[model samples]
Target: MTASLVSEPLDIASIRADFPILQKILPEGQPLVYLDNAATAQKPRAVIDKLVEVFEGYNANANRAAHTLAAMIDLELDAARSKVAALLNARSTDEVIFTPGTTAGLNMLAWGWARKFLKPGDELVISLMEHHANFVPWQQAALATGATLKFFPLTPDGRLDLDRLSETITPQTRLVALTAMSNVLGTINPIAAIAARVREVGAVFVVDGAQSVPHGPVDVQNPDIDFLVFSAHKIYGPTGVGVLYGKESRLRELEPSIFGGNMIRSVRVDGSEWADLPARFEAGTPAIAEAIALGTAIDYVQAIGLDRIAAHERMLTERAYAGLSEIDGLRILGPAVAHRGAILAFTVEGVHPRDLGELLDQQRGIAIRVGHHCAMPLHESLGLASSARASFAVYNTRDEADALVNGVARAVKSLRRKRS
Candidate 1:
């Protein structure tokens, strides 16, 4: 289903109560104001309780044995897969393959698909704002396959220059990889528009949804996205669990990069037959507890509704953007709030990001992400060594946004005084 901005407000107080960490007080006696959502989000009670239930109730190897405990675990695993498929609006549950996280899923595609299919004279296109998880794999793939790697230039406002699509994606372009939302710039790319362009050139479209899936609704079928990847930890679920979604036809074409137990249909001394669609990709023992807990996380998010969450985050992002803009010599990255998600990354003149981060945490207990945020290329492109980023979530508040701004202002004053 397509997500539209909703006018109904979220009960931020109620939502905050679901996350126990939000109530944490720092050692310095300041209440925590967490704004580092782009890195990872705090877990809700529902998700945490699910993890406990999995371990305490029926801990067994999923889909491996016929015993009662294994059967129960298998049921939970299937439910989680169904939840992820429903979340992404995938055509089939088999389209979703479990990975350790987004990084593993991307690496699987690079090694299994790109390295296998790409050859010399072929072009692989990616954007400049990709996180290292998305960028490094393709760079390595190109190096191995002798394929030419090309980049989509960004607009001055840090958006992919869609106007140059024709020039970038040509007949020789075999694959186009891009992020649905930038972790560093918080710029939301037009996935559907770009997917259509990739289809026109008969190129595979891979979307890194690590930062976008948690914030809004994503229908993979609507965009006809060939492949998509995202992490559970970023969506208030347990870490070490992620999803790789591929079109049924596309997945069948990809050779499984990883091989081991549970991923094989039959094995002989000389050769072994691969398992069905998803199982073929999911090798070894999967993250049983984390994957199951991810279903609960999806249940929690779906209960609140993504449209409502998006609208709430938009309001907070706008508030933070306006506040940060007022700071002297502070330059916020990416486009206006309307063009981006609920993230604010800015660099203050003569103020190191690490120092500001330390002051915010030690003094104000305001948690924000600093440094390149795993997007060193994006930082380099912006001509910055690092930036301080404050990303919002559904549970965040106007007061928290204010705290970030006020804390930054205070930290800037202190840091500037020391510099002088």
Candidate 2:
């Protein structure tokens, strides 16, 4: 299969060369193979340099300052917002509101909308595949509003159990929150389909696009979604920067999560009011430096081409599935879901997942994630304590995949042969 298709020059070798960490050799003399992209991707030199430049050269508060340095920082911040909007195919930059990260964004949405829309009889539907970032905010919101939280089950094949959803989503459903991709199982959900169904029930659709945005193309316009949240760090950008995309109309109905500073327009001794849709959402001084770095990161990825990135990871995923399957007592939990983004989680028999992870680290200099991956509900559903996960990015090559395969196999064998 590798020979059948022309392996286009991903130029990731050159890209990897740009990352200083990639060049370092361990004291044990092993090369690093980063397979933990889903957890957090390594920042490129450009992003790092940009962060330094902003923090050192033009360090200033955005939106609150009138000086030259402050104006420069504000310009950079606005540019970052534009880049985020462009990435999501948003009509204008105003739809994009910056946050600390996806978790913060989700929390903001839940806080703002729950009280305004949810009531005692209302329902909030989420897929069983949701990561805790997507699931917990609404879950708590439902609790606060006395609204019911319902989870749609997954298909036997590990995809969303959409067939059962028609029955699950009733007239009282106020919101449907779903993950765009399964971080643990590597299942890419049919969010557009789910969005359509949610709209039919007169419910608002809130998408956790944290995984989906980094993997490939995502257009908020296409889904007609009410709200979308994603983290910049996962997409090879800086930490402390995230995006919250809300439909303009829906933004009007929601109240501000935090009440202070820039978000307000009028304040009396007794009462106050908010600014506009997007501004009202951003309460305090945002992550200025990180946002600028995120802009640069977005530019880098877009120039590299997300489609090509997706295709490269697709090849790697296929190779990973086949190679890892040969290991004894290892089990893949998700759909042998072929059309997934490059995130795979598996459980190893007769060995602790944490032990396997440590072995891969110490013996092979490979970084693979272990645990429920923050989705405790899904792991418990399958009766698993934890699992091993390897998520890929565009910079990963066939050699890295080969290293991962060998690393995993070696770890399992070593663990099983250990004397009691």
Query: Which numbered prediction scores highest in lDDT against the true structure?
Result: 1
lDDT of 1 by residue, 1-420 (tens): 234436767789999999999989889999999899989999999999999999999999988899999999999999999999999999889999999999999999999999999999999999889999999999999999999999998999999998998999999999999999999888999898899889999999999999999999999999889999999999999999999999999999999988999899999999999999889999999999999999999999999998888889999999989998999988999998878998888999999999999999999999999998988988898888899999999999999999998999889999999999
> Which residue runs of candidate 2 sit more than 4 Å off their true CA positions?
1-7
User: In TM-score terms, which candidate is top?
Assistant: 1
Name the lDDT value of residue 284 in candidate 2: 82
Reference-based TM-score of each model: 0.98, 0.96
lDDT of each: 0.93, 0.86
